[model samples]
Target chain A: MKLYDLELSGNCYKVRLFAALAKIDLEIVPVDFLDGAHKREPVISLNPWGELPVLVDGEVILRDSQAILVYLARRYAGQAWWPEGAAQQGEVMQWLSVASNEVQHGPNAVRLVDKFGYEIDKPQAMRLTDRILGLLESHLSSHDWLALGRPTIADMAVFPYVALCHEGGVDLSPYQALDQWFNRIKGLDHYISMPGL
Target chain B: MKLYDLELSGNCYKVRLFAALAKIDLEIVPVDFLDGAHKREPVISLNPWGELPVLVDGEVILRDSQAILVYLARRYAGQAWWPEGAAQQGEVMQWLSVASNEVQHGPNAVRLVDKFGYEIDKPQAMRLTDRILGLLESHLSSHDWLALGRPTIADMAVFPYVALCHEGGVDLSPYQALDQWFNRIKGLDHYISMPGL
Candidate 1:
């Protein structure tokens, strides 16, 4: 399988982190954002969204980092990375939605705003980040992982973006439970690092 | 199950629609948002995010409309509504993410802004709606449904807010494919209407 990867993006890191944890081998193709490789159709014909990481296995082309992680988990069962039952599976979906919306806009958005040199809407970003962190902290306080009593794709999808949210100028000190949860995910058998910008 | 509902809410409508389609009976409980009921606890205790359509199934307090849809789909699987398999399933997640993010900001957000008499950011909202509608049009051009051959949770999760994009003053004439797709979903066996403000 081949993955169109961006080293600094948490979304891209999700796919890599999942691949690493699952011990799956993928040939990584660098999509140089600075060089405008993403906009170039020769590369982007694989996925029109023009986002990374795009996973290509045979004829299937999947976009959205969360979608890719779900794909990986389902394609290879016994990874214990996906929920087996319905309620737990729903929790996985719930967290994925949260990761994309709340996490994307919260700490992740703050970080993106900083990285892209975009003006930060300080009050909105802070409130959103605090709300999301509070949710994460409260949930983590009672649970070892995000959902399903074990490490699942939900955590794989949410953790990277949130763990690195401090880059957005949001302090992590308040979410001690979340901080501990992050460390537990790091202690996984095979883990990869993001080359932060 | 007791559903906390708000008539004009797309999120709330999606859950009710799912319940209707799945034939899972729910005890409907209206939340008077105009009366500041959202500020009250127990309700706030269900979802700190303070969104509508919090499903209290015995003890499981599920927030986030998309998550609730997923939970219903998985928890009651033998039904005809939920998508099956990886590619189709990934497609479900993809549309779910789009509905939560792009749809949330474009149609859903605009709807809220207008209904609540908030100032309109016409240029920004128009751009977002156009981008989203364009993508939706492209997806619907070839496929009959959002993520599955049949109408699945993906369509159920997204259709309510998206079809009402015009409620937010978004022009829908350009999206022929999506318009047809909307009609198709509305043509479902147990289609329900979204209440006006």
Candidate 2:
């Protein structure tokens, strides 16, 4: 499979991490968002969203990082990465939405602000951070993983940006359970770094 | 199964459509999003995000509409409302992501703009609509549905906003094949309308 990716994007990193967890070796094609490579025709053909982490598995091209996670997990079913039952499946998808709305809008947006050197919308971003972190804190209080009591692609999708939330000026110190939960998720087999060429 | 939903919401409608296609007789619990019912303690307790289209089936209180789709598909595995194998499953997730990003951001956002009578930033929303519809047009040229030449939750998740793009002044005349594809999906056997009460 070919994964069109970016070096420093946490969203792109979600796919990279899931690929690692599922032991799926993929050819990574780097797209330069800063250089407007994502806007180019070639990259746009793979994903019209103008985003990175498009997975091309033969004739199939998948976009959206969390959706890619669901694809990988389902494609590689019977692995611990994707659970098989209803409640577990629901849990995975629930957290995937959380990753999309909260993690993406919160710490991830803050990272984009800093990364692009754009004017920081500090107050709004900070409010989002607090909202997301508070949710994470409560959920991680009893569970080791986000889904099915095991490490899942849902966790993979939400982990990187949240683990690195401090870099975006969102301190995660208050969520100790989330801190420990992060460590637990990172402790899985065949972990990989976010793509940084 | 009870699905808490706002009748006019495309996200909530997606979940309802999924349940309908799966032949699941889900109880509809209308949540008044505008009336702050979603913000009430009971619903908010289930989903910290306080979002709509939450699925409650026994102990599983699913918070996201996408998550509800995953749940229904998983529980009713014998149905074609979801794909049976891996490759097609990736397609399922792909369209689900498109629903979340493009469908939600483009047509759905525009519908809200009209439904709430908000002054639209038409230029920005137009850019989003054009890009999304263009992508859909290309995909529809080759595929009958979002996955595996059959209707699935992926189509349901994306259809509502896309079918109603005109409410936001989005002209769908450019996507001829996609227009046919939309009609096919909306005409499914077990299809149901978004809840009215």
Among these predictions, the greatest TM-score belongs to 1
Candidate 2 residue lDDT tens string, A74-141? 77646577666777777787777777666766787677677667454555567777888888888889
TM-score of each: 0.93, 0.85
lDDT of 1 by residue, A132-175 (tens): 89888988999998887888888988898788878888788878
- The reply for model 1, stretches above 4 Å from the true place, is A118-123, B77-79, B117-125
State fnat for each of the candidate structures.
0.57, 0.60
lDDT of 1 by residue, B63-96 (tens): 8888888778777756366555666667677878
Q: What C-alpha lDDT does candidate 2 achieve relative to the native structure?
A: 0.76
For candidate 2, write residues B1-197 as lDDT tens digits.
78888888878888777777767888988897888899897889877778887888888888877778877887874646665566666667777766765666567767768767745454555676788888888878988887768887888877888888788777778789888897787677777775321
RMSD of each: 2.3, 3.5
Task: Give candidate 2's root-mean-square deviation (CA, Å).
Answer: 3.5
Worst 10 residues of 2 chain B by lDDT: B118-127
